[model samples]
Target: MIIGIDPGQSGGIAGIDGDASYAVPMPLIGKDIDGHKIAAQLKSLTPDVVIIEKVHAMPKQGVSSTFKFGMGFGIVIGVCEALGIPYRLVTPQAWKKAVLAGTTKDKDAAIAFVRRAYPSIDLTPGRKRVPHDGMADAVCLAEYGRQIMGNISEVS
Candidate 1:
């Protein structure tokens, strides 16, 4: 199994086990708090690999976002490393392009593409029936990981 995470002010987790995909939106937390959540999730899944979103610091945005993202990412990395699960960090652009391709750059467009890709999966946002951007992004990362691994198998 492989899990892909899209990290941000709010983060998302997507898991691909065999041919199935599952995703959920999660609150971003401090290192101490997030470590517990990561452990719980990892314990449930027991994934063979964990793919986390690479933190890309934007210019002029101060250090707060970077720090938060980095802290969140660190907890995830630590969990994966300790469990001996291989991990990969993919860039936002790479995941977006892989999922959206020629679609618009808007979040809604990306969500639509995700819905189309995983029509059977339920990724609705919030308590309401809206699409979750974070979850959708995570799904994209999962699918992208699938594609990459599929290509690698073909090459080998």
Candidate 2:
């Protein structure tokens, strides 16, 4: 199985096993990342490899928010390491180019692309009941990983 993670409060984690796929919003305890919960989720998935979105602080973002984002990213990496799950970081541009192809590079476009690709999968598993960009991106990242690395033994 392969796992893809979008590390942020609004972000999500996705797992793809054969033709089956599952996704959920990043678990949080209050405003902080619930590392234990995330670790448990990852352990349950038993991913041979994890693909995390390579992200950086954006200009105009507040210092506090940037710090929190960095902390979230670190928590995800730490969890993977604790479980000995090999992970690769892929930039949004790179994965989008591979998975989204000719579509415009934007949240709406990503949601549209994933909706079309995994029509049976529920993109909106949260309370909002709306298509989620983070979940869509997670699926894209997983697809990218699958494309680049064929089988479980092929993960590097």
Candidate 3:
């Protein structure tokens, strides 16, 4: 299994193996992060290569939001380290170029791309009218790792 994570409140985590994949929002309830819950998911999924987004705070962002993002990132990394899972951190630019180049550079475009890539998956029609871009990105990130490992031949 390959697991990919986007470390933020609006981010998501995904696990994929062979023809199966699972994606969900980051396990954060308010300020307290449920690391145990995320750990459980990863333990169950048994990722051979865990991939996480290598993101940094932007200069225009507020201090509190940046700290929160960092905190969430720390929790995810902590669980990976504790579980002894082999992992890699991929920068957003690299992954986006590798996986999202064909898409139109928007959340809806991302949703459409993931929908086409994983036809059996229901990444479309998320809560309300908003598509789950985070989920799509997480899955795409996992696919990026899979491509790097030569596990899948989809990358161009």
Candidate 1's residue-wise lDDT over 45-125, tens digit each?
A: 987666677876778877976776677777778878887777788877776777678888568876897778777767775
* Superior candidate under lDDT, 2 versus 3: 2
The local lDDT score (0 to 100) that residue 68 gets in candidate 1 is 67
TM-score per candidate, chains pooled: 0.82, 0.93, 0.88
Q: How would you encode candidate 2's per-residue C-alpha lDDT over 25-61 as one tens digit per residue?
A: 8888999989999999988888978999999999999
Give one digit per residue, the lDDT tens place, for model 3 in 1-156.
Answer: 998888878778887788897788777766666798999998887789788888899899999988988988898899999999978888877777777887666666657767888876666434646667788888888878877876433222
Return the lDDT, model 3, position 128: 45
Q: Give each model's whole-structure lDDT.
A: 0.73, 0.86, 0.79
Query: Lowest-lDDT window of 10 residues in candidate 3?
Result: 147-156
Candidate 3 achieves a global lDDT of 0.79
Predicted structure with the largest TM-score when compared to the true one: 2
Better of 1 and 2 by lDDT: 2
Task: Kindly report which residue stretches of model 2 are placed more than 4 angstroms away from their true locations once superposed.
Answer: 151-156
Whole-model alpha-carbon lDDT for candidate 2: 0.86
User: Which of the two candidates, 1 or 2, achieves a greater TM-score against the reference?
Assistant: 2
Arranged by lDDT, best first:
2, 3, 1
Please give the RMSD to the true structure for each candidate, in Å: 3.2, 2.2, 3.2
Q: Candidate 1: list runs displaced more than 4 Å.
A: 27-33, 151-156
